[model samples]
Target: MNATGSVSGAERVLLRLADEAIKMGDDVVLVSPSGPILQHIHPEVRHRECKPIGLNGLRSPVSILKYGASLLRAAIVLLPLMRSSNVLVINNTLASPLAFLFQKRLLWLLHDVLGNDLRGAIGKTASRFFRLVIPVSYAAANPLPTGTAVRVVLNGTPLRESKENFAREGTTSVIGCLAALTPWKGQKTLIKAVAELAGVDFRLEFAGSAFPGDEEYARELRVMAKESPVGEKIHFLGNVDPYMTLQSWDLMVLPSVAPEAMPLSLLEALSMGVPCIATNIGGSLEILRDINGDLVPPSQPHALAERIRELLNDEHRRMVLGEAGRDLVSTKYSLEERTKELYWVVAASTDMAGKVPPRR
Candidate 1:
């Protein structure tokens, strides 16, 4: 289950997993409040809309009451069907509590480190109800209850052969940042770093929309870019298809101030043979551990600027890192490998013999 049908990183991972499951001849049903966004991607996966009654995660008394009602309603809807299934995989913490009614068949996939106290408490409480709690990264798994049955399954992406050889000798380098326009995403830091590189012949593109109520933050980033000395070189492409556009860039930058949990964009960049420079926090470290990319201190514009310049100046290093990143993704983060692991987890959790379908 997922909160929405929006094409965020988590949602993308769900769609990919569902696609792989269907390919393995398993019947897959995707439940969400929002309309099914995966229909175009995986036409065979069943879609069910259990419309949430009200906004989730609000702290107000009324919001809390509404959230509880929504959970109860969702539980009523899901409990009957889940009890008969061999295994049910929940994508996030919002719907984790519903698993209590049918905890025997439930597995919770913890996608984040729970940045808020209340949510963390709720997640910890819910962890007891799940048969297995799978985190996308070791960093995400560190905060869970000490004795809870836990597994770390790094998110995966489809590996694509890169077209570019990363040999930008004279042409202007294009650096792209693709993530939601939130404060912790650190787009402002990236803009500042770009401003510091005013003398360099490069262009910066910001390709993501702001979350609800964060439009002002997005506007603030655009204003900051406009006011910078290199304003003319910065472009706010607002939300473009990273898969189709990332290959055109010389490098990708993810300067997040907060701990990111296995960003799919980083994987996509690496799969496309694009060298990435990310902030040293959360899953970025895990993603870049064996790769040849660079990791700078989070929220440090000067360090980010220096690193960007260093990579831009060395074309050979960029090519080497890009190649290494592609190889890493192919070997470690491929969809087939992750799907196989997930299938085994389900089979093991359910105590089923050879229930894992043969790979296509």
Candidate 2:
């Protein structure tokens, strides 16, 4: 169950898992906020929309009251489903408390590092009630209670065949940053770095929309980009299909200042043989293990720009990195392998007995 309605990395991962479960002859039901985003899910999977909830991230008293009300409402809606299902897999920690009602039947999937104080406290309290806590990465698991029943399940992506080497007729190298346009995502840092390389023949493509309360921040990014020396070179592509468009880019950049759990974008890019330049923080360092890509210090435009320039000038190095990235993803982070691991955990947690099917 995902708390938010938006089609972000967590939502995509949940959908992929549900699809994999369906393929294995398991009945899959998705309970999320009702929206057009639901259209992306497989038709075989059952879809249910939870009642619209107010912003739970807000620290205001009204927000807290609304969050409580939303949880109560969610519990009421889910109680009936909980009775019929052998296990409940919750995708977000905000909904973890609902597991308290189901106890052993519930599995909480942690997709991010518990950064918020209040949320972390609540997640810690809720962890004791859950049968298991499956964090998507080691970074995600580090903040959880030491003694909790935790398993680190690294997220995966479909392995794309390496593309044929193509000569770029265009002069400018395309650098794509495929993430939400938020402050901590470091889009501003990237823009600053591009501004530093005023005469460089490279275009920066920002390909994501803002979060709910981050519209102003998106506007700020636009203003920042506009004020940059190479303002026209910065293009905000809003939201594009990364799988379809990522292959067109020469390089992928993830400049997040905050700790990412395990960014699906990074995985997807690597799977498509796209070399990455990311900030050396959170799961990124873990993702870029063994020099799969370049790692720059977070919030440093000069460092980021230097790496970007270094990559842009060296075609052979970029090709080698891209091939290595694809190899790394195919070997260590395939969707089928990770899904099998997830299925095993689910099977072990429940009383499936002989009904638990073998991995396909």
Candidate 3:
């Protein structure tokens, strides 16, 4: 795990997976390049901390070599750790760089939809060791080679305990985008969209922390929000409780420019009967389309803004959409079922099936 402070959907899923594994009587050791993530580790799980590969370094010619050495050091530290493992579950292609040291005993729980660029090429190349590649969504699987070992395992969100009331009276309807503040997550696009909503009586909340080394972009977002005409209505709520957070909003938005494997925020929001509008891309498209939820074109703040206005005005439609989403969540995305399926897959795929029993 290339772990960090900002607990986005991926981090939440990782922690949840670990908790589930341990609950099922498996000994789970979370090994990672140390960061604020270590602070949030469960007491039940053994966290083996290692030095971070300085991928967060300043741009320089020698920086590459320095980081390369750092990566090597981290890999070496983790090699012995992996050798003892029965089934090594790696989230995304994060551990791919370390694959050369111990290639065989790895199960890639793939999450990224890398493009046809150099990074993507490298990610694909590393798939030579992916004895089992389980993508959280079909969109994530689409980018990989046709014959590559790919299994589509859509992320399952636990149902919200509290019922939502979309008809709550409010002079200022709150529009929120709950995701890690990053370039690809499209917080910028959301800000731009909200900026255009000057006539709309709405409060926009950007509820997430920036990535470890990406504070500059977070600063940029604050500046952008400050400069907008409705700047006072826009608030930056850093790392609030996602489940509790979704309950307060009249509408939720995920305006990601790039493809996510599957964002848990969307799932959580929808599960709670909150009306959501996400960009028509990757897993978001598949999810929203299935529930007949609203979606706008990626990077088109104008379209997003328009959709936001339309949804906020139509209370009945918003209620219906919310209900539909919640229904889908209840019927299909049960967390216990998904976790069991994951264990079954892991057990069935590897020779260490006996070691990785479906339950402890």
Candidate 4:
């Protein structure tokens, strides 16, 4: 997995895949640009830190050249790791070419959409370079879609809650922003919506952390929260255990202002039987179907606030929508079924070699 490989959604997906693969008696090798996130890896999984490749530490032209050298270094180092693996699960599109080099079976599990803003994450120049190169690399990599483009794995959720009935009380409802505390994610927009509904009996919870080098943005979000009218009503629970966190909320909001490939948080919220109110953009719309919840236009705090009000006032509607969300996830995003389908896709296209198929 070449993702940032932290405790984020992508990491969660990778960890689950690695853990299950281990139980099924498959030897898993996790490769990252930096050293392995040893703390997060499954005990059975092997870790290798490939040289930092692609756009890391490459802002200036000189650094870009250095990073290119690093890419070559990574490719050289990863060759052996690639040769030993039968199935290669790639998280980011940028690293697809590296996996392609060794003829490794590719399961391009995408968590974010690739586009201008995503490219801009590294910087304008890096973004432009990626836009130029990634598409061709992705095309050549030839990855098969895994049943659903997005999968949500719900861990640490109480199975008993699945059978229990919870009371639907007041406008004192919860709107959860299940994303990293970054500007691009639009947690500020969710806070603004909460501010708009200040006098209304509703609360918003900001649940997630900033990425490795984004502490500054996280601080800004803290400031924004304090200034908002519903500041006290909005709680910043920085990166809680997702399954447990979703249990306490009635609603989930992604509100990503940037383009996204897929937002797994939507899937997590759905699986936990919580209704969502996401922006009408990217993978948000793809997951938050009309039957499950509302999808308002991006950056419009008013629209978000109004929708929250509607859902808060109507308990029956919320229950119906939440139940529908759970059902949709159960049928479409079940990990076992999706992973099995993905296994076939990898097995069919790549050389499985001496590895035996895991028992169903």
Q: Model 1 over residues 271-350: C-alpha lDDT tens digits? A: 98889999888899889878746999998999999999999999999989989999999998987788678667766777
Best by lDDT: 2
What order do you get sorting by TM-score, best first? Answer: 2, 3, 1, 4
> Tens-digit lDDT track for model 2 on 1-360?
767777888777777777777877788777778875588888898877797554337589888888888888888877888878877787876787786777767888788778767877778888878888888899888888766899888898889865435445576789999998777798988988887787688888999999867899999999988888899999999888887678678899999998899998998889888889998888888899755569999999999999999999999998999889888888989988887787777767776545666556
Where does candidate 4 have its weakest 10-residue lDDT segment?
128-137
Superposed by TM-score, candidate 4 places the C-alpha of residue 150 at a distance from the truth, in angstroms, of: 14
Assess candidate 4 and give its lDDT: 0.62
TM-score of each model, in listed order: 0.90, 0.94, 0.92, 0.79
Candidate 1: where are CA atoms >4 Å away?
36-38, 52-57, 165-170, 351-360
| Clash count in backbone of candidate 2 | 0
Cα deviation of 256 in candidate 1 (Å)? 1.3
Itemize residue pairs with steric clashes in candidate 4. 112-261, 113-260, 113-261, 208-239
Pairs clashing within candidate 1: none
lDDT string for model 4 (1-360, tens) is: 664545665666667667766766678888775543668887777887765455333357886676557557767766676667665666554454543344323455555555444333332222222112211112221222322222232222112243115555564667788888777798877778777786677678888888766788889888888887668887888757787777768777888887554567777777767778888766666666546468888888889888888888877877787788777767666766655544444444456534556576
RMSD (Å) per prediction: 2.7, 1.9, 2.5, 5.8
